[model samples]
Target: MMSLNQVCPYCDITKINKDIVSVDHLLPKASFPVLSIFPDNLIVVCKACNEVIKGETIYLPIAHPCYEEVSRHFTFVIKENNNNKFTIEIATNSKNSKLINQKIYNFIKLFKIIDRYEKYMTAELQDYRTAVRTPNKCVFIELGQLTLLPPNLLLKRLFHSKFQPCFSY
Candidate 1:
């Protein structure tokens, strides 16, 4: 069941190799043992995300996947560096609400999402540059391929402007 997911929703680790995914209790089983039995409380995440990033720490405002579609409130800003690499930053879509913005920030911090992405971006950017530079190669930038990287904006802009006409089917 865990392998069915292409990437970890929290940390965005691609499930390419072994089964490095594990079940994580969103509310923490140590805190709410009764909810441990509830399927809704369980979220399948990467091993690093479950054990290292989140650990036993609890988060308020509950970005529970079952109840709240909290991800829509966040946006990833991708900036191209002069060295042909990219830097990614997460920004909250909700500018007016402090509480909503704080929740978004806490979620990012708790999972160390940016740190993880930064590590992967160097390699992914290199691959991206190579794919784009190669001629007649249809570079399909699927949203699923990107996962938490960018839902829409980043690659779309890159292909249009930087890559100078790449094909996506």
Candidate 2:
């Protein structure tokens, strides 16, 4: 399981809170029974994405977001004609091109992550636009300065502020 502070390794969202909808099998447990209980094979996911994307058998060769190096397998494409709609497209250089394509197709159908997350992402993007237009005071101070904090100081502060006493130590 990922730490609470860690974002969804798949969707790369850090805003996930206690309402953590479900556990995602990083390597679809149905296909890889041996890895079912593996720690790295599980991740926390928002209810919306989890409920929509799991529990199906499609003979696609796409790597799990957590298990496979997604950067090399897919790229996010914002369609120019679809009101900037975003979709993940398979990389042409992917070793198992056919399987990857199939996986991508099936994964989208299974998860319905496109339309669901698209609405959320669109709202988020709008928020970002608003932020850019009128920056928030708190965010402005922390934006580029996060890297300037000392490593120990950052760790201590993050743990102390974000976690319970057990994690704080």
Candidate 3:
């Protein structure tokens, strides 16, 4: 219960805001009414991952985030596209069981995580570029004025913020 609340375990990217957080039945209350209030059955997620895509959808016999370790099932890899934008993709290493693979697949598809992450990264990259190209301010200071989300974190991680056209963070 404590582990599921601060960050969205489902998407791994969204920082949980108290105002927008949602309680998701890891095992849906709709199907497993007996376990409806079970402590282990609930997970906290961002609103987009919960109400928007995963309402009432259930996948059983899979690696539950509460029961099984998530790193054993999927990995996040961020890549730069040919268009000079960034995108994040899940790399599911080869699993011994086909069912395990399906669980990972269903999790990714239902949450639309790949697209969501790509969108975030894309916007961040654009902002970083804009900040660097700003005339008077330092890229760091300029980006601070641009958006609240930390672009420098991913910017530093992927491209190391070594910009050719603009200043580095």
Candidate 4:
């Protein structure tokens, strides 16, 4: 069995101390019985992202966010306007656009992650707004311009810090 501390191969979020949730097959195991035990087919995902993303579908061609280097396949774009509000856009049309879009849509609808995490996302947006408005000169100078990293990396870092013991084994 894979360790619970294993970073989610899909989201790259640490899963050490957090509730283990479940293992997700990169490919739907039931649909591909022959490859059910394939190492390449398995991924650890947080319960929220997994349950929300996995709907009725059995097969998805999109790269698993955890184990697979899916960052290469997608990009995030942030836009700010005169009103000073910011909007986040996840690029869906990259090399794996069709496949990725389908998987993303499925994930959004099935997992209801958007709805479930609306408050969290909103709070983060507010933080960004404050940062932009106040402009922390010292921190910005020391750290350099804060580039928004992908969600996977953010999740991974949060998971790692919060659940350090999970990585011990």
Candidate 5:
């Protein structure tokens, strides 16, 4: 997670505490029983992206957003309407075009990410504002070094983002 910067590649539009963090078998264990413990077949994702959205579902032969780097295949468009509500859409500027767009579209729709992200856009923006307005600039880097955490998580701890430790272990 630290390597991925602690953000679930799928739908980490909101802050994720450890309890909801889970391991996803890129190839579902139910389908490929042999790959259940295969390190290469695993991807760590938040509970929502794992259980709630993709449980036992397979999107293989497409992009897994990890080794495949979905961001390279697509970008996001954050649109703000007159009502100040934000909407996120997958961009159509993929160098590979059609198939990539469709894959990302399917992933987003599967997770209802536009709606989920819209629900927390304000809070995310608020956190960003707070970070920009913080009196200490060096502290973020300092904290990251001290905790060995990634930038996004450093921001979460520094700004006290909406997270409660839900992990039992």
Candidate 6:
């Protein structure tokens, strides 16, 4: 039962387009027919995540967004490649809890978070590069302002054009 104003739990994308927001079955109806109508089985997620988690094929234990406070267990690590490209990885910090570790792993793999994030980062870098090269464009990112936002909201701002530009004529 997530609101559109919130980020998608799976991918951490801000739902800017209402058309892409959808009610996804946490456990696909095709596989869990009995739980199809179960209230807990339904979650609000962006269409991209729905497409990625198409159905019952994801049998590995994933953290239930409603029941599990799993965010603290995982962290995103981004590494820069030699060619100025970047790759992303999700590292689990729950060393004491094997089950939590497994759920984090399964969630990352099932959602292809690493791959998708890398793709997004690459595209974002390209956009930034373009913005930087455009003449008379005054762009500045206020890292200090981002500190006030939650992790997901900070990411949403970073990924979008939330960084305001300062101009001096």
The estimated TM-scores of all candidates read: 0.65, 0.48, 0.63, 0.57, 0.58, 0.72
User: Of the pair 2 and 6, which is ahead by TM-score?
Assistant: 6
Model 6 clash number: 0
lDDT of candidate 1? 0.65
Give the per-residue lDDT of model 6 (tens digit) for 1-169. 3456866877775463577777778888887899888888888778778864544556468877678765667666655568867666566664638887887777777777777767766666556556666677766753334333443554665665454555544
Candidate 3 lDDT score at position 132 = 68
Candidate 5: which pairs clash?
Answer: none
lDDT of 4 by residue, 51-147 (tens): 6566335434444555445555444445554665545556654566576777665544444433543433445555544544553322221111212
Candidate 2 pairs with clashing backbones: none
The local distance difference test score of model 3 is 0.64
Question: For every model in order, what is the number of clashing pairs?
Answer: 0, 0, 0, 5, 0, 0
In terms of lDDT, which candidate is stronger, 3 or 6? 6
Task: Give, for candidate 6, the lowest lDDT window spanning 10 residues.
Answer: 142-151
Candidate 1: worst 10 consecutive residues by lDDT?
155-164
TM-score of 4: 0.57
Provide the clash count, candidate 3.
0
* lDDT of every predicted structure (CA atoms): 0.65, 0.49, 0.64, 0.49, 0.59, 0.66
Order of quality (TM-score): 6, 1, 3, 5, 4, 2
- Which runs of model 6 end up more than 4 angstroms from their true locations? 14-17, 94-96, 125-154, 164-169
Q: Which stretches of candidate 2 lie over 4 Å from their true place?
A: 26-35, 38-40, 52-59, 80-96, 123-169
Checking candidate 1 for backbone clashes, the offending pairs are none
Worst 10 residues of 3 by lDDT: 143-152
Per-residue CA lDDT of model 1 for 1-169, tens digit only, reads 5455455666544452356767888888899899988988788877888887787887786566546455677777666678866677876774528887777677788887777667665566666767766676666554234435443344344332343336554
For candidate 2, which ten residues in a row score worst on lDDT?
160-169
Q: Which candidate is the best by TM-score?
A: 6
